[model samples]
Target: MNYSKIMFMIMIMLTTLMTISSTNWIGMWIGMEMNLMSFIPFINKNKNLKSSRAMMMYFLAQSIGSIIFLFAILMNSFIMTPIMMNEFIKTAMVIGMAIKLGMAPFHSWMPEMMSNINWNEMMVLMTWQKVAPLYTLSNLMNNWSMYILIILSTIVGAIGGLNQTSMRKIMAYSSINHMGWITAMMITQTKWFMYLLIYSITVAMLCYMMNMHNTYFINQVSTMNESMTEKLTYSILMLSIGGMPPFLGFLPKWMAIQSMINTEMMILMTIMIMMSLLTLFYYMRMISSLMLMYSSMNKWMKYKSPNTMMVSLMLTINMSMPIYSIMSFF
Candidate 1:
């Protein structure tokens, strides 16, 4: 319970929210820098050697991205008209956002960085920390570059996760894969917000479960000897994250696919669906171990109870699926 770190985290969120709500590019950059600086201190709160190294790595990468972003902004400022802005400036902004968002080609830092941080910090890295950069990426006005990133991200995110046994790395790739869909949704311009919201909630749920169980590796998941209720709760959450049917995580993918179809992006939709299935395959692979119940262990396991708070949180997150639809009516 480090209150200073908590305050910094709150500042990060506030600054990012400010960035998104800003209409002026310079004000947005100011807010973005505040967000980055606040996160650096928060991440460095843990004094582990690995954490220190990770903080340095993250700081360097983010600084470089910020510099590039600032250059793009400066270049754009010189333009007298919106139509007068050059492709190079737009592409520069796109590249900067991609780096910050950890999209493919610029994504090497994410998995490595995630492995070095605590799971709770990793949750912020995967979800909340991404909001401003992703919103910026969506507004870059470079559709062609974004399209290329969408293809590259889905391909890289899928292939990269195929051989990983580290839960954090798997989640890193999952984040990238979801980013591809989010970027694609940007083309439709109206649906990316919903996808981002759902993705954030689903990711938060997965991270909370993982942190509660103290699970780090995929193999660790299979070996967890939790009670039936606990096992089933986490398993369902994992399946939902992998975009399986009848789960909250599936809703975003469903909406994304519909958006793609509406835009006649059949190939992109097919690739996203295929990659989603691949992700689910790996989740099922890990879950197979949990599903194999021993008859002798059943009696003892039935009596065990999991954390009440976590169970309540998971239930609330799961209920978001129906709640999302109900809210859509308004």
Candidate 2:
């Protein structure tokens, strides 16, 4: 492992933690700025033009968000009435953080940026980068506005990916879809941290598997003549990612649905379920392509085994919930 890269990532997480733990807006802004700077160095480290473009877009988006946040903080300091100041501040903060979180209307940058980077960077972008902004939004934004954003994100994520063929772009939409669920859970004050934890781990496992197999596009899976075991392994991964029943991925979705129903958000839950089904359609499409090839293969080559660590992590992700549930009785 590269110690310097690991250290930079640690700093990134530390700064996000700093933002979340800060008491004042200025402290939080400073922490977020630190986090942003640390992250810029980590993106597009390969010196390619596409990666550079992605980094630039990410920087501009983040910088614009920071400016808006700081302006809101400054304006709030001068306003005499708490009521007026709170309104302006909340509006500005929500818009700013929405852009940072790549919530829809401000979400186009995400798929474009994801397209330029590799799976590892995409994993970080999808999961860890969401921590501070999302938590901050949960703490500060009004429930009504958050709900609206949640619906918009789910709708956009579902529709936008319908025509996409790239794996990273598909994952980008998937992240947006999951964001809607995450926001809904946060709005309901459900166990959002638990949701985030499982989401991050599942995304990490999927990205790791994708990285190992050098699979970058949906077409690549169907075109590359892979072993039956390889095809089957990835098929299960795709199913798990789509939140099929009995998989670890389904656990969080089930929890969120239960929470939504309990809150009498039946209509919202119905829309979310329908949109989630749209995402699953493409996931199944990808898996079917692989399965079709798997069924026709003539002779299987003896495979190079996966890394022990990779297999262990995959098993842990797939089995962690079931094992925990079993252990609960003891």
Candidate-wise lDDT, in order: 0.82, 0.81
The best candidate by TM-score is: 1
Candidate 2 residue lDDT tens string, 1-330: 778788789999999999989877788889889999988878957788988998999999999988998888888876533245566578788888888988887898999999999989999988889998887777664535677788989999988888998999999999988889998888776488888888898888889878887888887877765665555556766777777876788888888998988889999999999999998888887778778653545543335565644554575567566775566569
Distance from true location, Cα of 319 in model 2, Å: 4.5
Question: Candidate 1 — which pairs collide?
Answer: none
Show the lowest summed lDDT stretch of 10 residues, model 2.
Answer: 293-302
Q: lDDT, candidate 1, residue 266?
A: 97
Residue 60, model 1: lDDT of: 79
* Per-residue lDDT of 105 in model 1: 82
